[model samples]
Target: MDQTLTELRTVNVIRYVTPLREGGSMPAIVEADDGFLYVIKFRGAGQGTNALIADLVGGELARALGLKVPELVFIHLDEGFGRSEADEEIQDLLKFSVGLNLGLHYLSGAITFDSTVTQLDPLLASKILWLDCLLTNIDRTCRNTNMLIWNKELWLIDPGASLYFHHNWSNWKEHILTPFALVKNHVLLKQASKLNEADVFCKQLLTTERIESIVALIPTDWLKDEPLFESKEAQRNAYTTFLLTRMQHSDIFIKEANDAREKLI
Candidate 1:
């Protein structure tokens, strides 16, 4: 792990190849100036930039914890991006997303992770389960693992649905200590037998400085229009605080996950 905060490289989208509609956000594969394809998550999607913020924070946090995640980049969509597109819907999508977006490096020849066919060590599974609990990620379910096996390693993807508390920030602080009931639905919950080990290991890695660095990665454009906050900086501070608090009281969710697992097995 680098242990240093490096800004994501910004790449201009040169071509919109095709849309991956498997996700509700409708992220697409597009060719960038660097000649690599990225799955670009549009800001015009239903959840807006909140989804982008979650992707950046959650994905980077996973990387910080020594997990495999595809490289994340800032995809710049010019105003003239989809003018020639015959599909009116796609053109509108391009028009609305004519600014900064989030992209993940396309994993060629990757296969969806199936838990039934492959078994992971209890420690790794516990770590992953702990991560999802800390982020309040509700998308890593049996139906949609949101994980891929590329190069014979498990790679996490599409954390846009994590940090869902931000979607309704009315009482965000209250969520900090709440038990994540959704962990029972997590696909790896059954295999997460070492929550205590994962808790200690993950906390050591996710220091206050690291948490601040991860929250700082959120693009200013994503937070600028947040109506609840007076400025983007304040919004960023809130995210940093939320994550730091969660790390401090990790046992709350860890026990919840353990209980859920006990019920399962």
Candidate 2:
């Protein structure tokens, strides 16, 4: 993938359609000025902008690795955008999220993926499993999957729970090269038979330049007031360093995941 293609298109929110209550953060479906509906992740939601950062980094990383991820857009929520909303909680959320937010292009007519019903190719399953491990994503369990079957193909979504280390930067360094033991509970763990091959393919795609480019997509406002770093640049560098280091030590996580898979089978 071309490094220059990392820029996400920005769209102004034209209408607030409905809130997705299933998510703890209460993400909403909104219509953008571009005439498309998006599942908007508010910066002011309970999870805060860290969740937005995770979505941006994780979604873009999946794209770079040739995985299926919805198109990400920077959503501009003009002041007083949701003033007419009757729900107090939603009104407060919209009030705080008056500036930039993150959104995924809404996948209409898509159904929640059922791992038991939908068998996946082993290599493809391995790629998805490997990605979740790399991001330390804890949301893709059998109960919630966080996946969709759109147009007869599986697509990944809702990556906001990833990169939990960023929420508390105090022990961030200790997480580098750490094995993601949680992979055992992944929805597709049983089908991910080609993890090593998936690792090689992903490593070749997520080069240092590509990783830096993905981290650079994070908006500055979201990085502001971070207590851990002096500047947004430092914060970005920390994320890039963490991901690259983890990739270098991919064997640790791969072995961990394989071992976990062994127990299940």
Note the Cα lDDT for every prediction shown: 0.91, 0.92
lDDT of 2: 0.92
Worst 10 residues of 2 by lDDT: 1-10
TM-score of 2: 0.98
Instruction: Count clashing pairs, candidate 2.
Output: 0
lDDT of 2 at 69: 93
By summed lDDT, which 10 consecutive residues of candidate 1 come out lowest? 219-228
Q: Estimated TM-score per prediction?
A: 0.98, 0.98
Q: How many residue pairs clash in each candidate?
A: 0, 0
Q: Compared with the true structure, what per-residue lDDT tens digits does model 2 show for residues 70-186? A: 999999999998789999999999999999999999999999999889999999999999999999999999899999999998889988899999888999999887898888899
